[model samples]
Target: MLHHLSIRNIVLIEALDLDFAPGLGVLTGETGAGKSILLDALGLILGMRADSGLVRAGEAAASVTASFEMGALAPDVAETLTDAGVEVEPGEPLIIRRQLKADGGSKAYINDAPVGVALLRELAPFLVEIHGQHDDRGLVNPRGHRALLDRYARVDSTAIEAAWKKWRLAEERLERQRAIIAKAAEDRDLLIAHLEELVALAPQPGEEEELAGERATMQKGERLAGDLSSVQQVFIGSDSPLAELRVAARRLDRIAGEHPLLEEVLAALDRAMIEADDAEDKLNRALDALAFDPLALDRVETRLFELRAAARKHACAVEDLPQKAADMRIALNAIEGGEAEVAALEQAAAEAGRVWRALAEAARAARTEAAGRLDAAVKGELAPLKLDAARFRTAVTPLEQGQWGAGGMDRVEFMIATNPGADFAPLAKIASGGELSRFILALKVALAEEGGAATMIFDEIDRGVGGAVAQAIGERLARLAGVGGGANGGQLLAVTHSPQVAARGTQHYFIAKSSDGIVTRTGVVQLDGAGRQEEIARMLSGAEITPEARAQADRLLEGV
Candidate 1:
């Protein structure tokens, strides 16, 4: 329930603060006394569109703050706040503030934490509901009718929603599988051809680098073989150096026994001969090592070229060919077995659809039964609120299968005939402004037990009706505020002109405008007993309170 409202620099309301109590509270004043301005101020905090024109002249900005004592926050409301990262303790006052700049900029806050205006709007339906003659929300909007009916019926849609989601997921999965299989079927021949080529090539990891190395070595060997052969010819033909050294060493050995010098010479000649023989033997081994078949080099080069060409064709490294071949084989296998998988998915989707359809049908039945009771209940309230001539109905029409949704297959709306012989029409289009407000009030009274915002504000709901009808409206407002045995013990505030309605308020606030020659300002004062009496008298007597008017005001208050 709204505990307090603070307004500053908003139109005529330069500054105003008012505290509210439970039950039905009425705001009353002479016409043009800024009651609407006050409601506009409240609207700021309620997430209504901001208007720079609402800012007071010469003021930089206008702001409104509302404090609500949330005894137990609704789950949806709590989730919205939590999701927005605005923490509010249970049973704490949820403060919402909005600032509107004269330049058409605005900001919103919840619990002192900055938030988007959309978040405020999201939380508005759970925090407060403003019902006016021109209101496009709450009961007047047909878009929300289904949810309202479900709420009225106390029908939990969890199972239905879950089934619908499961069905949709299954359908999506089936579609995806079908698309994959279709695309694969289109490429089946290509896949088989690619797999065949890769299998024939039989590429192996590291084979490309090994073959390239062997080819490089063989080419070098071919280049060096001629040079090595020339050196081998020199060593084999022996330019006679080794033979001459061997003969000189034998002669030196024969004279070595006669002289030490001759023995040294023989040792040196023998060492030179031994070195020459070892060099020739090493050259022959080198020639043998360089000998490789020319065909072998061609084979290695061919293999290397084949591996590189295959890599280019497949747009991968040679090492990846093996894995690619394996993947192609798997794709072919899936193609061969895809029909069975598709059949399984189709069966699953069909089963999900069957479950969803059953739940949807049950939901439709429940709404139909609830609509009957709702029509009767609203009709029962119509006669009391001066809508006795109007006939009310709840139309629960079934939607087509293609239009069905998680909410079920029924489209729910509130319809009214307005006259005995008239055809039923949508509630919004069938009534005059005054009649429309009455219809909404009757609907609200009927659905009081169904949870809505914690507070409800009726903007001049008792607009064109008076006397017994106004009194009845007042009584119903009181009942809605839980004054006696009303279904919901929530807060109800009304901007009213009827003294009977004013008298019904458990708390009264009087809005008045005063001019200081050049500047006009609006202010609100919480009324005492005497204050309320005089105000109601002024409402009855039109600016002059007569003694009889005062007496009548006393009677009205006494009646309440």
Candidate 2:
């Protein structure tokens, strides 16, 4: 419930602080006494669009703060706040603040943490629901009718929603498979031809680099064979160095005993002769192994060209061709698997559809049955509000397949006939302003415990009706406020002029405007015992409080 509201520097309200209790709180004042300003300030806290005109004349900004006690909040309220990252401390107040600057900019806060205006708007529905002459969003909107009926009937539509999601998922998978199969069919012949080409070529892994290396070696051999033969000639053929060195070493060996220097020279020459023979043998081996084949080179080059061309055609590296072939084979395999997979998915989808239909049909039946009871209950409330001839009915019509939703396959609307023999139409269109208020009151009383919002604010809902009708509205509002009814219930705040209505409030606030020499301001006073009697008397009579009016006020209080 709304625990407190504080307004500063708003239009006609320089400063005000209000502490609210959990029951009917009536704000009564004369016409143009700034009763609407209070509601406007409250609207600002609820994340309504801000206007610079709301600021006070001398101030640069206006601010409104609303605090709520959420210890006994509805489950939806707790879930919404938790999802939004707004922590609701147990046994503490949740505060929302809005500030409107004179420069046409605004800011919002939740528990003093800055947040966007959207979050505040999202959080508002769980805290308060305001109904005025033209506000029909909660109880009267046709789009909300089905859900309200379900809430009234205590029907859980979770199973139907879950089934619908499963059916949708199955349908999505089936469609995806069908699309894949269509694409595979379009590309089938091309894939098969490519596969056949790859299989015939039979390119081995790393074969491209191997062929290039072998080709390089063959080209180098063509240049090296003549060079190796010339080296053989120098070492052992035609040059005659080894023969001359052998003769020189034998002459030195014969003279080594005669001269020690001759012996050292002979040893060196012997070592040189041995190295020359080993070099000649290596040259002979090179000459034997340096043969190059032109046909082999041509074959290697041709194979390399084929592999490079295939790589370009496939838009991949030469080494990646094998993996590409494997991928295509997998794609071909999927084409074969698609038919069976699609059939299975279709079966699953059919089963999901059957489950959803069963759940939705049960939900529809529950709504139809609840609608009858709801219409009867609302009709029973209408006569006492002075609409005895008016007929109210909850219309539950089956929706088209295309329009069916997770909610159900039904479109629920509240229809009414304002007069006898009149065709039933939308309740909003048929009811006059006064008739609409009574109808909404009756509906609210019927759905007292359904909506999750803890506080309901009515901006003069009892307007233009007086006597027993006004008294009836007052009683219903009190009942909604849970006055003398229960320990824990919703709160009702009504801005009213009816003395009966004002007198019936568990708490009373009087809004009035006062002017100093230069400026005007609005203030509210929580009326006490004598103050309450005097204010009710003032509401009964004109500017003066007459004895008769005071007596009438006493009677109204006594009746309450």
Candidate 3:
């Protein structure tokens, strides 16, 4: 419930502090009495857009603060505040303040701690709701209708939301696979050609470098073979040194027995012959090491050329060709198995769709049943508001498959038929401004505790109605305010001009403008017993508090 509202330097309001009670509190004054200014100040604290023009003349800034007692706050309110990083303690007061500079810049605070405007806006629904002739929030907006219906029906909304997210996730997975299949289908021929080429080439890792090195060695060996051949001739091939040395050693052996010196010369000649034979053997091995089949060189060169050409075509080093080939094979494999994968994805998506439809059907049934009850309840209050001939309904229209969302497969709208034989239309389209206010009041009355705001404010909900209708509005407002009830009851505040309405308030306030020669200021004071009677009488007689008006005011207060 709203515990207090304090304003400073707001338009027409220099400084004010107003404390509120739980039950309906009424603020009444004549035209141009700054009632709208009060609501504007309250709106700022409720996270409404700021305006520089709202600052009082000669003031540099304006500020408004609304304090709420949180003992009766909705459970979600505390959780939401905590999630937004705002500390909330049960049984403590939650203070929301907004300060607007003359430059149109603004700042907001929750519980005396600085916060963003969005956080303030998030907290608004939990604390208070203000309704007026053109109000679209609370029960009027279609976006909130589903939740409202669920709240009234006492249904578990999280179940529907969880099921919807799962279904949507499944759909996303299926769509992703479908996109892959589509792309693969477009490039199928190209992938198949690349795979076939890589397979036939069968490039082995490290084969390119090995073949190039071998070819170069062979080419160098060809140049060195000429020198090896000449050395071979000196040792054995076509060379006369080994034959001549052997002949010289035989001659020396024949003379060795006759002369000792000749024997020494024969031994040296034999050693020379042995050395020459060993050198010739080594030369033969060297020539064999240098030998190669002429065609072997050509084959190596051709294979190296093929590998380099493939490397260039693929725009990678020769070493990376193997990885490229592997990648191509994988792509081809995916294409080959794509049809089966797509079929599996389609099956999964179908299963998810069935689950979503079943859940939506159950939710729809619950909503349909709840809609009937809500429509009946709202219409029940219409007769007392003097709209007995008007019809109220909760129009639950089925949505197309493409339009389905987390809420369900239906769109809920508050529809009304204002006159007999008239077709039911949207509440906003068919109801006049005065009729809309009354209709909203009927909803508020019917909803009762189901309307979640801890504090509900109606700006002249009784406007343009009088007599019994005005009295009914007054009674309903008092009931909503929870007059005489303890802290557990909700709070209501109304800006009204009807004397009957003002007389029913548990607390009454008078809004009046006073000027100090240079500037006009608006002030509000809680009316005492006699002051309440006088204000009501003034509302009844306008400017002149007549004797009959006082009697009527006495009668209204007596009823309260």
Candidate 4:
């Protein structure tokens, strides 16, 4: 519920502050008494587009702030606030502020945190609904009509959600099939080219790495072979010096005991012979390692070249060639899978089409039933508003396939006939300003709880209406505030000029203009008992309030 509103530097309003309460609070004033300005201030905070022209003549900026107590907010609102990282204390006011600068830019804030204009717009429907002759032309909007039908039909949200789920499931299956179909339609030339490359390469996982290792070995083989042969000749080759060392060591071993000094020399010679023998054994191993046939080297080189050529052809590294081959295989497989997927998706799409048709039929049927009741209810209100001769009807038209959308396959619009002989036409095309207001009132009364918002505002709801019709409007507005026998159980604020409308309010405020010639300003004054009577009387008798009008105002307010 909106708890407080503050305006600063707006056109004709230098500064203003207003505190609103539950039930219906009416703002009453004469023509050009700044009543509309007060509502405009409220609209600014509700995310309406800001114009620099709205700023006071001498001010650099204009701002409006609206405070709402969201302690008992709807679940969606709570989640929204939670996601925004704003704490909503049980009794705390959620303050929204919008400011426009003379520099032609505007800013908005929620709970004192700067926010984008998008968020402010998103929050608008949840906070208030301002209905006036010119502003609330939405009563005739086809989408609004469809929404009302759904609301009055008592269509369970769960059922609608389930229907959407069914539609989505079918849609998903169809999309999957379409993607498959597209894949299968690829030119055969492309597939053949890809397949031929993979087949020619005949690559396997890890093959490139193996060939690389073999190629490296072949590249270094020439130098290694020479080194190994030289080493082997020195140690283990039959015509090598190592053989002479062995014979020398044997002679030394045999003569070691001939002399004491010769013993040390013989022992050293024997050790040398042993070391030389070990070196010969190692050289034999080296000779074996370098003993590759020419054909083997040729084969390794050929395989490495093949692998390198394939890598170049595929634009990949030697090691990545194998993986690329696998990828190609997958693409080829997709060529086959595409046809099968297309069939599946085609079936799914057909099923989705069937499901949507059935659900839409059911929704349309529900709307048809609801439309009759809706038309009857609104028509009932017309007589009291002095439109007994008027005819009201609801028109529902189904889509011709191309018009399918998230909403459904049908369009609903409220049609009206102002006179008995006239055929019912779109309300917007036929109804006068006053008629539109009353029609909206009837709809609001019928669908009060259907919308998810926790608050409602009716700006000048009683405009271009007076007498008993004005009384009916007041009664309905009061009903919205739970002032009538039935409890709408939401806070409502109305700006009005009708005495009956003003009398229906649990809270009343008088908005008037105050000027010092050089400076004109707007002010809102909360009225007490006598003040309220005077205002209501003024509404009834204009600037020259008469005794009879005052008496009538007192009686009207007393009844309320």
Candidate 5:
């Protein structure tokens, strides 16, 4: 509830401060006594557009501050503050201030901490609701009808939103999978052809390096083969070194028995012959190893070329050919198996959609039922506010599938038919300025307990009606403020001209304009019992408040 309001340099309100209380608080004055200036000052703190003209003449700037005691902050308000890093403890007062410069610049603050005007505007709905003949927000706007209906129905959209997200995610996955499969199908034939080429070549890891090594060895052997053959021939013929060594050894053995020195010479000759025979055997083995087939070298070269050419075609290193072939085979397999996966995904997406639809339909049903209750409650209030012939309705119409959203598949709007035979129309379009304010009041009275601002200010709601009609508006306002054991007690401030409505206020304020010849100023004073009586008498008797008017004011107060 609003606790206090401070204004400075705003139009005629050069400097003013007023403490507000709970229940119905009425502000009354003569028509040109500057009641609207007070409202405009309050609007500044509520984040309404600022006008440089609002700054007092010759004043540099204007500012307004409002203090509200937040017993339990609304969820949206708490979330907004938390997101903006503004900490407010439970039971703390939320202080909002707005400053307007004469140059059309402005700044906003929350609890003395700097903030954006947008943030103030966002928090305004929870802090207070201002209803006037020209108001297009709150109950009058069609865009907020769905949310208001949901609040009224106590509909929890958590499950609905969750289901929607899951369904959308599933649909996205299905689309992605379809694209993948389509692209893979487009390349299916090319993939098969590449796989075939790789399979035919059958390139092994390190095969390119091995073949190159073998080719180099074969080329070297070709250069040395003739020379090696000549050496082997020398080792094989009868006049070779091994044969000559054997003849020497035999001659030495014949003379070894005749003399001791001759025996020693024969032993040395035997060792030499053994060593010479081993050398000749090694030479023959060397010649056999050098004799490689020329056709084998051609085969090695052809294999190396084939592997390299395949590597260039696939844009990969020669050693990567085996892995590349394996990947291509996997691609082919995916293309062949894609239909099964696609069918499974389609089933999943369909299931998700079904779940979302079920939740949305349930919410829609709840809103439809709630709309009936809301319509009846509002209609019950119409007659009291002098709208007996007018009919109110909560229109819950089905939305097209393409327009369905997280909230549900229904569009909710408050409709009214001003006459018995008239067609129902949108609340804003069908009502006059006075009728619109009355209709809004009726709606507020009906939805008071659902989700309304902690404080509501009605600007001249009792206008153009008096006597029993004005009294009815006053009684309803009192009930809305929780006066006399009424439910949904909060705070309500009304700017009114009716003495009956003024008499209903638990608290009263009088607004007046005074001129000091050169300067004029507007001021507000909280009224005492005598003060209230005098003000109400002035309202009843116009310029001359008579003794009977005061007596009638006493009766009105007594009735309240």
Candidate 6:
């Protein structure tokens, strides 16, 4: 229940604070007494759009705050707030504030936390609803009719949940397969390029190491060759060591029998000659393994350079080229295999569509049954509300091939026949001001216990209604409010003008103009006892306060 509203610098309302109570409430005043201004301000606090023109003529901004008594709020909402760390004084209230600047920027807050306009809109449906001469004729609204029908048929909500799961799973599978197919397609071009490069390079694993080892061996042989060349050069020089050795050996041989020391000298000369011969044989053997081809070096350089370049192109080190090329070939095979997989997927998608159509058929049947019953019930309800000559209907029709959607491949609309001779037309077209108001009320009464809202607001529901009819409308509102079946918790707030309607309020407010020459103003009060009587009397007698009006007000209040 809305407990309080505070407004500042809002049009004619300079500053105001008003308290409210549960059950039916009424606001009454003469013409131009700012009754609608009070509702407009409350609407702003309840998250309606803001206009810069609403600011007081001299003020830069306007602000309104509405406090809701959450002690009686729905359990689900109360629990949500508690879980979100908002401390709830079960007996206290929730305060929502809305502010607007002359520049037209608006701001909203829920329990002091800043929120977006969309969140504000969400909260509005749960809190206060504003009905005007121009807004929400309800059961005459197609969406309203659908909700009523759902409640009547008890539309199997679980079907939607089951269908949603199937739909989501099918969609996920399609997306995953599509990604795989796309990746395969990208790999096709890439694999051919990689395979061509690898085939051209054709470097064996460990070949670089072998070439390096062979090069080192050749280099070592070159060193040995230098040593051998030195030995040969030394022996072949002008004063040849070999010549000296031979001369020494001959001398030693001639004098060998003459002296044992000379024999030792000849043996040493023979040993030196044998050592040089052994060195020459070892040098030849080492040189045999030392074939150094410049062409082989060129091959090695070309292979290594190509490998390095490929590594850089693929963002890897050169040694990883073999593994990378193998992976690319695997990817190419995957691309080649995709056509078969895509065909399989297209078949699966067709199967999903078939399954959806089967479920949709069931939904459509249920909806049709509900719509028929709803049309009959609303018309039945309208007859007693002095719309006996009028008719209410629900029009459900199928679509052409391209017109499929989430709500079961059909259009649902509300149509009316306001006079006996009138052709059935859309409610917005054929209904007059008075007929429209009653039609909205009749629909509400019929669908009151349906899948509507926890609270309904009717601004000037008394439009074009007076006397007995006004009293009937008030009785219906009271029925909607008090007959929530002992804990269902439905409520209603109707802005009205009739004395009979005002008398039914469990709580009542008096809206009046209180102003100085410089500023016109609006004020509201919760009325009771004699105060309530006077307000009702004023409603009965227009601008006058008469004794007979008071007696009539007393009788009406007594009746309520």
TM-score of each prediction = 0.80, 0.79, 0.72, 0.78, 0.74, 0.70
lDDT of 4 by residue, 406-463 (tens): 5677888888889989998887777776677667677677666566455666666666
The segments of candidate 4 whose C-alpha lies over 4 angstroms from its true place after superposition are 71-93, 136-138, 161-165, 171-175, 178-355
Tens digits of per-residue lDDT for model 3, 393-446: 998899998899888899988889999999998877888877888898888677
Error of 5 at 201 (Å): 15
Off by over 4 Å in 1: 198-327
The reply for model 3, stretches above 4 Å from the true place, is: 70-93, 111-123, 185-333, 336-344, 449-452, 484-488, 544-555
Error of 3 at 466 (Å): 2.2
**Local accuracy of candidate 5 as per-residue lDDT tens digits, 192-220:** 99999999999998999999998988888
Q: Is candidate 3 or candidate 5 better by TM-score?
A: 5
Ranking by TM-score: 1, 2, 4, 5, 3, 6
Per-prediction RMSD in angstroms? 7.2, 6.4, 10.6, 5.4, 11.2, 10.8
Candidate 5 Cα lDDT to native: 0.89
- TM-score, candidate 2, is 0.79
lDDT of 6 at 326: 81
lDDT of each: 0.87, 0.85, 0.84, 0.76, 0.89, 0.72
lDDT of 2 by residue, 216-293 (tens): 888888989777766665666434767778878888788898988888898899788788878777766665555589
Q: Can you tell me which runs of candidate 2 are displaced by over 4 Å?
A: 72-92, 195-327, 486-488
Native-referenced Cα lDDT, model 1: 0.87
RMSD of candidate 1 to the truth, in angstroms, is: 7.2
Total clashing pairs in model 2: 0
Candidate 5 is scored at a TM of 0.74
Best by lDDT: 5
Candidate 6 Cα misplacement greater than 4 A, ranges: 69-94, 136-148, 161-165, 168-172, 175-355, 449-453, 483-488
**lDDT-best of 3 and 6:** 3
Q: After superposition, how far is residue 344 of candidate 2 from its true place, in Å?
A: 1.8
